[model samples]
Target: MATTNSLLLGFLLLHIAIHHSVPVEGHPNYSDALAKSILFFLGQRSGKLPPDQTMTWRSDSGLSDGSTANVDLTGGYYDAGDNVKFSFPMAFTTTMLAWSILEFGGKNRMSGQLSEARAALKWASDYLLKAATQTHGKLYVGVGDPNSDHACWERPEDMDTPRPVFSVSSTNPGSDVAGETAAALAASALVLQSQNRTYALKLLLAAKDVMDFAMQYRGKYSDSVWTACPYYCSYSGYMDELLWGAAWLHKATKNATYLNFINSLGANDITDIFSWDNKFAGARVLLARKTLVDKENSFDPFRFQAEDFLCRILPNSPSKTTQYTPGGLIFKLSSANLQYVTSITFLLNTYAKYMASSGHTFSCQNVLIKSSTIRAFAKKQVDYILGQNPLGISYMIGFGTFYPKMVHHRGSSLPSISSHPAHIGCNDGFQYFFSGNPNPNLLIGAVVGGPDQNDAFSDSRTDYNHLEPATYINAPLVGSLAYLAGRYGSG
Candidate 1:
């Protein structure tokens, strides 16, 4: 396997040598390119784009969904490959975005990404404020029914289907969604604190109130809307999110109450993997950050657990549980597993940097764990996604010369037509899921569902699970890419 990997790496380098413009190695301007990729998703927003955003492909979409339901839902990002906005995942994406900005936004301020990130942050943060600050603090979880939105292939701006809204209240509780939103707002407050102190305080106060609501009334958002289970289900329950929200609040405000809540949990209470549903690993990472950077030993209670998490995910750790693709991606699931790989990559990369900054060192499997080693491991995953594997194709659209043209996305695949046209050519090529034709519009910087466990990838439009791109995936990619560009000179 080592010999085969070396041969493959040689071939990939040679391929890039011949095709200089390919995004494999020595690609200059990756920082700017990655920043643009993040902006691409923000521009794909269904509602109004901020003044700084020069959006063209999509106009106002699902604006009336708020008016019809008498609730403000004019902002927030569209979920993967569809127009429906699932608040649970959307809020999680916002929290990650804000965290990324808070972590590395200062390093690449000259790239103008800081401004773009701030725009994206405020867009989602403002929408979250609206969602949480409703009558009697009821937070809406799902906007636009998934079934109704998936029934037809129409632009979000032109859809005529019922855009139903779902909410979580004291009677209908949703601790997972509520807690994640609280985390998002809390992190957003930190992102905005330097520039807009007033807005940041407003977000923090709201986050505290919302966290209280989530803890006081505990349940998953999917309980209220049964249809949301298959899409944004809380498989790991709400305790992780509650702790996660409290952790972020403690970090942002340094309040002892929030710190007390986090210290109350057991050290081994965390799960290894971090995702939209699972915040245990992420909360641990944040806690570890506080311990290392702030020199605050007050987090002594979680010190052992944080060290355990770091060791478990390391390449040579005895407790390493994450499986890898044959081509070397940290695989977790069977389908579109690259999303999980990329998300975990950011965490590992950030944690490694934290360790490096603090001059921390440890021995695993007779090999010393250093920041450079951890970062090198994280960089391998980035290269794999950008055409270093057996398939040798970039999963992120418009990054490399070769990529998937049929990315199972309606907005990019369907023709842009004005006016509401019912059943407009819906049956034209629905049968042949792998449309021979390229997508009508180019969704640049949009990374589609990635390859399978065996490094097998089919660039087909029919395979939604393997071709769809979600905001959560892109959120982590932004941070990882930024960190890479800063650490290793782009191009």
Candidate 2:
């Protein structure tokens, strides 16, 4: 009888989530969180800083990024605290940011962050437009050398590092990076469609061209550009990117060919995870949208895969994967753990919305899994990120009373160009890097690579694994924050 009562109570909560937003007690101001998350991009921006750029500490740098190759790869984003502009993860970041607006754009609008989101997205897309169209059948994978850049810790403005232009062509194949970029362009195109149709069409065309390159010349990007190895290597291979790219292309154009491509995906490629390195799970979740919302029976396999992932993530399910900290944080990896937490939570919130709005109930192990429970779990994780954890620290910089000040970012650590106009040599900035003091300038809004399995964080600038903030870590998080901000409006 006690077990029966507990089940009934769970179901009641789930039912409420379907009809109303679950009142997440102690959730930090989500709208504020969203605003701050968007602000992080301004700090991460590469190339010429806009006049209105709020991250004043960040100055124009990497202006001559592709000059060696005589191609202008000036924009996009820096991959992490280090200055390399790796296309694979950079493209993934753009896709997630655009996806956030696509999912909860209305919420951003209400919270007055829609334009900021679009602008931040445009910064990357504009760079992508330049990067992808540099040559026909050629896609530049990265700019700047990670080893050399890591050797010297200087501001992007003051550094005189060797900027080597890398690419994957018909001869040097890299389907993964190409396909990921295609997906990014397609996702961004969708976001810009109603806002700027002409630009959207231009992006859609670029996506098609890149997707063609990815499909025709089949190979891993990291394989072609050996430099990217040991860093952003293609761990799960190129098949996932090809499928993930096709899904986004289908989304942008409703092209049946792309759908057929996704439908024809191999069973081996199916998985229940999403990350910069792997998109198999993200692909499943995206394709499931069609099966659930559009009622496309052909995409049923992906829908089932999506449900499997949900069951594992939802703790009450019998077959659930035990991947949580004692504090209820969805801990996956020890290093940069929040990446998994944010990305997985985004899917949970996304699927929850899809199910609730479509009036579909989720079942696991012959038990009902309410959309509310999924989102409630998602919210709990987000709250942990925003200062409800054992550490009582907000992992997202600049959102709460206390955040990590020793963010492992070179630009943020050194004095701004405006302050210290004197040139700091490429290698002379090690003093700034090793300093025990907090970063001179805050990397406001950067979602740092978070805590250990025990929910403990080492807030040291030297602790790159747990302290370094990356583009990929913050991207999917933008979508999650926006959705929650909208759900818990004006509160």
Best by TM-score: 2
**Highest lDDT model number:** 2
lDDT of 1 at 479: 79
Q: Model 2 segments beyond 4 Å from truth?
A: 1-26, 107-110
For 48-107, candidate 2 gives per-residue lDDT tens digits of 887999888888988998999999999889988988899999999999888888887884
TM-score, each model? Answer: 0.91, 0.93
In order, what lDDT does every prediction score? Answer: 0.76, 0.85
For residues 1-491, write the lDDT of model 1, one tens digit per residue.
99999999999888765563444446445575566567667545867655554545556677776776687888788878877888888888889888878776765532567777787778888888888887575887778878866776766666676788888899889988999999999999999988899999999988998999998998877777775867788888888898889999888888999888776655256455778888887887788877777777876545456556656666677777667777878777765576677677878777787887899766665667787878888888887776666776788887766788998877777664432333344344353234688887678778777988788888888888788888888887777777777765455
Steric clash count of candidate 2: 0
Clashes of each: 2, 0
